[model samples]
Structures are given as structure tokens and as C-alpha cells.
Target chain A: MSDAKKFMYINRKAPYGTIYAWESLEVVLIGAAFEQDVSVTFMDDGVYQLTKGQDTTGIGMKNFSPTYSALGDFEVTKIYVEKESLEERGLSLDDLQHLVWEDEDEDYAEKDSIRLVSRAELADVLAGQDVLFNF
Target chain B: MKLTIQVNEGPYQHQSADTAYHFAKAALEKGHEIFRIFFYHDGVNNGTRLTTPPQDDRNIVRRWSELAEAHNIDMVLCVAAAQRRGIVDDGEAERNGKDATNIAPGFRISGLGQLVEGGIESDRLIVFGD
Candidate 1:
């Protein structure tokens, strides 16, 4: 665990319409077992995956939006949402889920995991990754 | 270099599978080691042994089976993805009550943890997606 590699799941597509979003989430959930330094990025249409009030009954599909909250429990504490992508799609931080994680080292202190960053900032983050699982 | 490949598209439906095959071949020809080739998403279709293409066409599924056999590559189709798309192995068929198994040779069904392991152990983890 001390030598955990930086693993990032880059989401660029929307949910439901295609299998990419759901399958991408599936990969992330399963990858949690590795106990790596994991992060997820929501950009482009991927920003829509974190929106609230998802109703998939009409689409005859399982609503997987709530799974975002469980990511914190998987030890994936970094969830990056690009500010430019949100603004381009007429969205703000308020439109997304308020995801948080608990720090066991600090007596389980609750901490916000959703980190809002500019496109440039996200680029820097992407560059620092040891492994990037693109979706 | 030790490499791993994740194919996210099915054979013929998209160029991803084809490109990944070529890339793996090129790498092997250059004396590179393929740690694993984990198929996910629609890529599970690559493992089905039921495919039958025209005689003149390149048999994509067979191509993969042959490649893996030749290189002794660990070619895996994600269990969840394969189950969703109806790609079944003998063990999976018995477990899921499926009458038949469609998984090809040189391939096996496994969990997504395999993909994560590839990312951790390989020198590079390349993805071929839509």
C-alpha cells in the first residue's frame, strides 16, 4: 500500500445512452480492490454522470448514479470535475453530487472528495498519473 | 517492455479490436512481453466461438485465439461484460445455467481486478476504445 501507483479513470462520455459510462463505473468499482491511489475525472459529457435526481425507470435501465457516493468507501478519494466542461454544458458544482470521504488516519474525519479544477489544472493532474484508464 | 491491452469494442463493429491486435502483434514481434490482454465492454464479443465470417475475410476471433496461443498471452474477457453480452465459458455456463458456452480458445472469463493488476504490473496499459 505504501507504493500505491496513481491510477485515474478518465470519463468523457454521458450515461445510459451508451454502455461506456456504466461499464466505466464497473471498472472503477472492481479496480478498488487493488488499493491504489485512485482518482476519477468527470469532463465533457462525463459531467452528466454525477448529476442528481436520476430516474432510469423510463429508460428501462438500472440507475447507477448513486454509485458515485460509494466510490468514497472504495478509498478513491479524489473526484475531479473540470470547471470548463461544466460551464460549457451550463452546469455548476451545485448541479453535481456532494461526494465525501472519511480519513481513517484523522479519526475518520469527513472530507469532500469532489475537487473542482480548471481545464489547465486538470491537465496537470492528468500528467501526474502513473496509470490512466481512459473511457 | 511489459504491456497490457484493454479492448473496449467488439470485432468488426469498430476498429479498436483490430488495432489492438495489430499493436500486440507489433509489440511481440519487437520482443516485448504482453502481460495480459483484458477485454471489456463490447470487447467481450471477441471471445465468442460462434462467429462465422465469409471464407475470404479474416476471422477476427480465430485471429485472437491463434495470437494468444502463439504468444501464450493471458487473454481474458471480463466476466460481467461477457455475461451481459452472452459470451459464456464452460465454468460460467454451468454456474449461470447456460446450456452452452461460446467462449473461444486461448481466452478465459475473469474479473475486472485482472485489468487493474495489468495496470499495476505492466510497463504500459494501453486501451483501445470507441
Candidate 2:
């Protein structure tokens, strides 16, 4: 019922094997142009999309992992990585690409863009979204 | 609350259509308005009327048609996806020179804009997919 809606893009699939991950990113980039409150959640196999040191040269595909870093420039700063998902995959914050954004309010201080949340916290975030895109 | 549901996969092959249907039914039972149900990707297959499942199996397409008829819900199938998958209404059939149109009752074929509009117009846009 809020005038300004909150949008959440849920990534449940891993990248490259299917088009879902790539298409989801396309939607997020376009959604950013709307200037609405946008957030993205990485859960399930989706956590693999952010794994750092991705080398797609052997896969014959462009390595789009770096696109996550550009999200902050598009004002899509809220990137939630579910704690359980990372743990299940034996990954930590160090395994993922570090995303940061400049906080102009704090005199242009760079701040981390990723928020590590538990399953319960992620559920609350999911419930709070006005629009959800899952791919 | 106004809700818009998106189904991104075909019936039976994936649980997306079933989940979306159940979610829509539950929302309607709670008196929430479903502004639109946009079917995209393989989800457009749910609108085809030519499906003939086993007699004992539930007819997913028919179930959606009946639900839309009962609630006057707007069921929209993405035109691009439908065309690629060969799911079309009479209008699309004629325009594309197709031999037949298979879109089921209470369903309409539309552009991707309908999905975006659904998001803008509804209070909540819930997506169900694989």
C-alpha cells in the first residue's frame, strides 16, 4: 500500500548453466532506472554467482561477475547474502566479490554493500518487498 | 491488497504454475485482489487450450481458466514468449499466419509491458518459478 514500493530480486539459481541468472541481472539493471528502492537477495545456488576470481575464459562466456560491483552505481546497494546459503556451500565473505558504495552523507565514505543475513532475517526481508523477481 | 502474480515456467514440467495457482487461490480467499497474472518464459504454455492431460491428472490449464472465470482475474501471457513457444490466441494467430490458436479461455496474450505495468499498479508482485 505504500506509494514508493520496495523491489527485491531473488537469485536462487547459479550463473552460466542457465539463462535465469543472466536474465535476472538484466531485469535488475533495468529496474534500477525506475529509481525505486531495489534490493537483491542471494540464496541457494545463487550464492555462487558472487564467487570471486571467476574466470569464464574456458567457458566461452563473458565473466559478468564484475557486474555486481557496478550495482552500487545504479543505486541498487542492498545486496543480501543469506548466511546459511554461504555456509552450506562452504563459502565465506572472502570468497565473494567485495561490493562497496560511496556514502555521500558520510562525506563520501566508502561502505560495504553486502549484508550477511540469517534465514529468518532474509525471510523478513522477503516479506517486506512490494515486488519480487525470482529467477 | 492488490497482487500481481508471475509464473515463469510451464505446467507439470515445473512446480511454478501449481505454486502460483495455489498462492492466487489463497490470496483470493483472503479477499485480496489479484490485479493480473502474467505468464512469461515457458510459463506461457499454461495458456494453451490444446493440452490433454491424463484423465486422472489435474488439468492445470483448465484449472487456471476456471479460476480466472470465477474471479474475473486478468490472465496475461507474454506475447513474445508465447510466439516463441507457439502459444497464441486468434489475434496473434492471424497476425503471425499461424495455422491455429491455442490460448485457453479467460487468458489473453500481451506484451512484456503488461508485466511491468502489473508491478507498478499492484501493491505486491509475487513471482513463482523454478
Candidate 3:
């Protein structure tokens, strides 16, 4: 197999209101099968995608918020949530879903899938990616 | 260096198509090769030849076609997205029982694999969207 390329999905839209967040997630799931170094960055309103207790019952739409938790199964473990976005929205790490994955190389220890980073730090991450999908 | 450009929004609705065009032109002028320009989501509308913009305005579709012709650039519209947005070529129009095919010149309908392949083949993949 060829060495994996760094693929980053930049999510800047909120879920439910538009199709971007949901469609972006679908691409990440499909792209994971390619075995690339896939990472998802949540910035701007995108940070709301990970907000816990998303109940779509009143919206008459299927709740797809749970899908974010399953991303670890596809080997998409690098989920970055922008600190500035969350703060601006009056949210914190505790308000988001706790995504975890098993590290087989580290004696099967469970590791947090989401990494909270500052805007400057996220800029560095963006610069390091080989491919960036913005939505 | 080889580069791939992805435009996610439609012309007039967003500046993605315009920005991507200038980026591609600048890259070509700098002696860089553009592996492909993949249109996804509403960006597929850019491949439709049916649009007749105002006489005074710049024709985005024509500009893209002319650029593709000038540089031999591969301009591909995502088949799935195009189908959803009613953008069709001769093959798709015939297959789907449509009367006319409106795909602009120099643009071809293709699968998402082309986007992935472009990412693999190109040194950089820049996405322009809303």
C-alpha cells in the first residue's frame, strides 16, 4: 500500500440547518476506506456539530448526531474542535460528545478522539494537511 | 507541482468558481500543472451550457470552457452531484430519458473517484467554497 496522504475535512457549517455538515461527515466516512491520514476540523458554527444532546425529534429529521461517535470505528480518530469557535458559542468541551477509540498499540487503552485546539494551532494543522475539504 | 482544485458552490451564488478559476490560471502561469478541476455539490451547475447570463456580465461557464481549452485542463463534474442538480451530458441525458444535454464544452461528467484520484496524484488539493 502507498503511504497515506494527510486528508483534512474542514467543517464550518452547522448541522440540520444545512446539508453541509451531514454531507461532510458522509465524505469522511467514505474517505476513511481509502486508508488516508484523515482528520476532521470543526471551526466556526461547525463546532456545534459535536454539541451533546442534539435531539432532532422536534425537527422531524433523523438524528444523525450519533454518527460522529462512530467515526473512531472507521479509523478517523483525529477530530479537532476549534477552541475559539466553542467559546464564542458559549460552549465548552463538556458540552460536546465524548468520542473515544482504542489504541491497540498502546495495550488497548482508550484515547480521546477529539482534540481541542486554538485558532492558531488549527492554522498550523491546516498547513500540514496534503488535502483539505472545506464545507 | 501538480495541483487539483475543487469548487463546491455554483457560479453567481458564490465566489468559489471565480476564485478557483483565478487560482488555476495563476498556477498555470507559474508553470504548475493542474491535474484536474472537480466540481461538486452546486458547483456542477457551472458545467451547464444552458445558462445565458446578462450581456454585460462575465460569462463564468464560457470562461471555464475557454480556460480548459487553452490549457488542456481536465474539468470534471461529479456525476452524482450533477444528477441531483439536473446537470447532464449527452450520455447521461440519453440514459435518463432527458431531451437535451446541457454540459458545457470541455467539461465531463465523472465519479467522485476522480476527486480522490486527483488528491492522490496532485501535490496539493485546494477547495474553494462558501
Candidate 4:
């Protein structure tokens, strides 16, 4: 087993609706800053957070999606997505910028790198994690 | 694995129930355990049985009941939130002289301390919100 403990964060809601996602991200960032291994899985509407062309200016909210890419700079690189979520919303990996997405249907088990995982794989991911935080 | 879910939205008012159901189902499938599901703020609406959504739409109350029954999940609603929202059980309803009670079955009303305990006890604390 790796010495680094893994943390999984499952985000299902949209980013702007509430502060849950923001608060959760803050917590995770702090954890990563402390040198903990961290991973994030965005599903349902939460996937929108990873899309490249975020324009929150109209709503007067500062665009924070860019901060997501910065997570890699902090060595928190395990970002996952649900395949059904992408297809259900007619999205693809190209929609995201600066980050790689795991396509669940292509590799539900995530054998290679941080692959996309099905609903079934979600449990396995949750099981292996030392810390799992949902937002 | 012991999972603690933080619920922010009321039952049926948003996608909180569906998200919780998905997580509960996945956790059980993996043979893991759910430590607790802490309901807070607007999440206390999950206990209200007074909802009557359109027939075409999903029945959140029934969905939650089925999920809890099948997985034996511990579903707790915030008591303070419930009381503030006027959702009471038979005892509270009678004491307050309400004509009817809105709290749903299989949902226990309790305090936020339970939520804090849940956060501390569980291996993972997942939050489902709007």
C-alpha cells in the first residue's frame, strides 16, 4: 500500500447554487496543502465545474473553475468523471481545458490512471479511500 | 468503510434525495457501511410527509423510504429544523395542537449534535446539496 492516504471528494450538485462545493473545495485544498493525497470526482451537474468556458461574469460571481486546474499544481491530480454524466449532458473531454477526464464507459474500473468510473465503481473508489468527502 | 452523508436540501425540494440514494446504494453494493446521514438547515424537510408532488414527477418520500428499507440506512432529520418548519411527530403535534403531523416515517428527528458526532465518527463525510 502507498504511504500516502487517499481522499475522495464526490461532488454532485452544481457549483453556483450553494456554497457546499466551495466549502468542500476549500477543505480539500487545505488538506492538500498539508501534504495529504487528494482526488476529486465530479458527477451529475457538478461536472459543469470542469468545463473550459465558464463565464460567471454575468452573474457577478468570480470564476473559480480556473482554480480547479491549479489543483494539479498542488499535486492533487486525480480528477474523475462519470461517463453517463458526460453523455447524459452531451459533454466530452474536449469541453474541459488543462485537465484530463476519465471516461467511465471506456474504463469503468479505472485500471489505467484515474479513469472514468460507473456508478458501480463509485463504491469501490469510496471503499479504498482513507477519507471521502461529498459535496 | 463507514460513510457519513451531509444533506443540505429538504427531501423532494431538490436533488438531495436522489444523490443520497445513489451514494447509499453504491456503499451497500461495496459491502461497506453508512455511519450516518446528517440532515441540517433546509434538509429537515425530508421528514415532512405532507408533500404531494404531481403524479408524473418522482415521489421523493417513497424513494427515501425504499432506499432506507433496502439498505438499512440511518436517516436522521434535524429536529430544530423540523420544529421550525412545523414538522412534528404525533407527540409534538398533539402538544402543539396541530391538526395533523407532517413528519414522514423512517425518518428520525434529532439534534445537530448527532450531525457533529456523525462527522467525527465516519471515515468519510459526503455532502449532498442543491
Candidate 5:
């Protein structure tokens, strides 16, 4: 049980524009059952996926943005958003969904899941992962 | 070292499948273990037996089948993705009420968990795609 591998899913594309973002989320949702140490990174155009308001009604695509809110239920507690990526897109933390997860060990307390970090800091996080899946 | 390769694009239009195929071949030639090769997204299109390439050109699907047979490699296509793409085996064809199946040799349909298990079991998991 202690040997759970570190798996990180790096999202670098915009959602709906391509199927990669949605399919990548599907992998994370399925991989969660294995109980590994899982995390996700949002950079480049991928930051658009976590934005607060996404209406795909006219596009005729499934609005899967709400599914991000349930990732914490699957123990995917570490959601990294690169600071530079947000800045480049002219976005701030308020533009993104305030994602959080419930901590069972702490009497079901709510804990913030999205961690905004500098690109340099994320490089260290990338180096620590045992496996990386990019989208 | 043990490795698992994930191919996310179709064999022809994109070079990811070709690159993944060559990488797997090279790994086998170097005395490495291939845990599995999971076909996902448009990658599932590589599993169709109905592919008809030019006679003078290289056969992508056949090459993959030959390599898998020679190395006894486990080639799997994501079931959900395959279903959406209409890459069905005999059982799937019957179950889904399709008249015929199009799955080629060396590939089987499975859940995304196979990829996850491969990533966990293998020494490395390399992805090739956009």
C-alpha cells in the first residue's frame, strides 16, 4: 500500500476545441480506482478548462467542466495551475473555479485542491512524479 | 527496462502511431520488456482490419500485428473509445448488433484501467501524440 506510484496528468490544451482534454479527464477518472498518488497540472491553453463559466450550448458539445468539481471525490486532491499560464491568458484565480476536496481524516473538513504555483515551482513538482500523462 | 506506450492518434494522418511503432520495435530489439501498448482516442482506428493502403506503401496495421505477434506484446484499445469509433471485435459486433467486426489482429478492447495498470507496473510509460 505504501508503494503507490506518483501519477501526474498534465493538461496543456483547451477543452472542447480538441477531444484530448475530455479524454484525459476520463483516464484520470478511471485511474482513480487504483488508489495511486494522483495529481493534475493545468498550463497553456489548458487553464481555460478550469474557468468558472463554460457554456457549450451553441457548440453542441457536452459541458464537462462541471466534472472538475468531482475530481476531489476521486482523491485527486492536487490540482496545479501555473501562474505564468494564467497571466499569459490575462486570467487570475477568481476566473477559475474554486475547487476543493473533503478530507475524511480531518473529520470531513473541506480543503482547497487548486494550488496556483510559479512555473519554476511546477518544474520541481514535475520532476517528482513517477509517471506523467500529457494532454 | 519495462515500458508501456500510449498512441493517441490514427496511424496515417498523424505520425504518432508510426513513431510509437518504431519506438516499440527499438525497445524490443534492445532487450527491453514492453508491458503493453494502449490505443486511445483516435488511436483505436489503428485496430481496424479493413484498412487498405497502397500496395507499394507500408501497411501500418499489419506491421503492428506482426510486431505484436513476434514479441507477444499486449495491444489494447480503450473499449469506450473503440466503441465510439466503431472498432469492434466479434463479440462486440454481436453484442452491439453490428453486422460485422473490424478489429484487426494483435489488438483487443479493454477499459482505461489497463493503461493505468501498465503505468503502475512498467518502469516507464511513454505517450506519443498531440
Candidate 6:
């Protein structure tokens, strides 16, 4: 109920087609522009948002993933990913140009911040935040 | 934890609604209070009362209604998006000269400010999109 000093933005969709991904990114940028402590996490198909070498020119849309790299410049550097998602999609940290933490450890389930987490761990993440915004 | 869920995708068109449903149910089951479920952009389609999927398939519209009815969850459909898409209540439908209003009963037509309020009031304002 109080002012949001810390913000966590969850992105759950892929880029292109719809504008949800774009809007969510804009909101995070705005939050960071205001000096808020912003953390962004990509889940589900949203993992595609951070995939390297995206080519949207053929689709008649501008490639926007590169803009995500600018988040670090805005001080919005805490980027998280669900480890299981990466494995399920055959994606590793090397496939992404951005900072990605894959919780490949068996003990990740026990340690709250040990890298990757289950969908259930999201509740804890949300519970600990002053603000949890998903897109 | 009190939370607000912002839905920005159409029902069944993507996994966004499913994610919202599971998360909402889990949040409620965990004794967390839900402040509201605000629909925007393509999400306004979720309030359509006339949707009829195959009998063998999932009926997301009905599922949403049941969730709202059971939990007393506030279901908000964006007024601007609804107007833009021609999804309206009886009055707006009449004024617009449309034959019928497709928005269901449990969901309400509201402004984007409500979403901002959700961000301000709830401990978490989760968005489901794309």
C-alpha cells in the first residue's frame, strides 16, 4: 500500500505480433528512469525476448531485443530467468547476450535465490517485493 | 499479500490467461488477497459473454466467471479497449448502434487508472500479456 521503492517486472510473452512485450519494457524503462530498483525476469515464451540475434525486419517489425541491453545503462541490471525454462527450450546462457542465471543446481529448490526456481517460487518472490509487475 | 493481476492478452489466444488463472488460484489458495483483475488491450475479449468454444475444449470465459464468482474477485475490462473493439454493455452497445453487448456480467468496464491504483495498493501487481 505504500510507495513502491523496489519494483519487480515479470515478462511472460514473446516479442512481435502483440504489443504487450513492448509496453512492459517501456514501463520498466520508465521505472528505471525514475531511479527505482528494478528487476526484470523472463518466463514462459517471454524467454524469446532475450534471445540473441533476433531478426524482425522480415516481419516488418523493428527488432527490439537489442534495446533490452540498454536496461543495464539505466541501472536496471538485475535480470533473472527460470532455469527449467531454459533447459526445456534448449536455451543456455551462452545463447543469450544478456546476463542470464540458470539455476542448474539440485539444491535450487531449497535456496530461494540459488539461480533458477520453480513456478511456485514465484509466489515467494512476489511476497518479498514492494511491487511485482508482470507483463 | 494483496495482489492485482493485469491481463493484457485475449482468452485462449495465448498462454497469458492460463498463467493468470493458475497464479490467481494459487495466490488465493495461499490466503493472499486479490485486489483486482484488470483486463486491457486484447484482454477485454475475456469479458465477452457470447464466446462458445467446442464442448470438448476449455471454456476460458466461463472459467473466468467462475473464478470471479467464487472468490468475489474484481474483474475489470478496459473501457477504452472495449470501446475500440466494440465490446460493450447494453447501454454502450445501444448508443453505438450495435446489435448486442457481449461483455459478461461479472466483469466491469473501467479505466487504466484502476490499473495504476492496483500498482499503488497491492503488494504485487502482476501482468499477463503477449
Using lDDT, give the best candidate's number.
5
User: Per-residue alpha-carbon lDDT of model 4 for A67-102, expressed as tens digits?
Assistant: 786675556668778878978999887786656334
Per-residue CA lDDT of model 2 for B10-101, tens digit only, reads 99999889989999999999999999999987899999999999999999999999999999999999877788789978899889899988
lDDT of 3 by residue, B1-130 (tens): 9999999899998888999999999999999999999998789999999899999998999999999999999999988789988999989998999998899999999877788778878888888887
Kindly list the per-residue Cα lDDT of model 1 for residues A66-122, writing each as its tens digit: 999998899889999999999999999999989999999999999999999999999
Off by over 4 Å in 3: A57-62, A104-110, B90-100
DockQ per model, Cα = 0.72, 0.28, 0.42, 0.14, 0.77, 0.21
Question: What TM-score, computed on C-alpha atoms, does each candidate reach?
Answer: 0.97, 0.72, 0.85, 0.49, 0.98, 0.56
Tens-digit per-residue lDDT, A1-135, candidate 3: 568899898999999997778867867877777878999999999999988999999989878899999998899899999999999999999999999988889997999999999999999999998788888
lDDT of 5 by residue, A22-97 (tens): 9999999999999999999999999999998899999999999999999999999999999999999999999999
Compose the digit string of candidate 2's lDDT tens values, residues A1-135: 336678788898999997678767866876677666889999999999999999999989988999999998888889999999999999999999999988889998889999999999999999888777777
Candidate 6 lDDT, B41-114, residue by residue in tens:
78899999899899999888899999999999999887777797778987687777988778886898876656
lDDT per model vs. reference: 0.94, 0.89, 0.90, 0.71, 0.95, 0.77
Off by over 4 Å in 5: none
Instruction: Give candidate 6 regions above 4 Å deviation.
Output: A1-17, A21-135
DockQ ranking of the models: 5, 1, 3, 2, 6, 4
Best by DockQ: 5
> Native contact fraction of candidate 4?
0.29
- Candidate closer to the true structure by TM-score (higher is better), 1 or 3: 1
Residue B14's lDDT in candidate 6: 91
Pairs clashing in candidate 6? Answer: A103-A116, A134-B127
DockQ head-to-head 4 vs 5, winner: 5
Model 5 CA lDDT for position A46: 94
Query: Which one wins by lDDT: 5 or 6?
Result: 5
- Pitting candidate 1 against candidate 2, the one with the higher TM-score is 1
lDDT, model 2, position A32: 78
Window of ten residues with lowest summed lDDT in model 3 chain B: B111-120
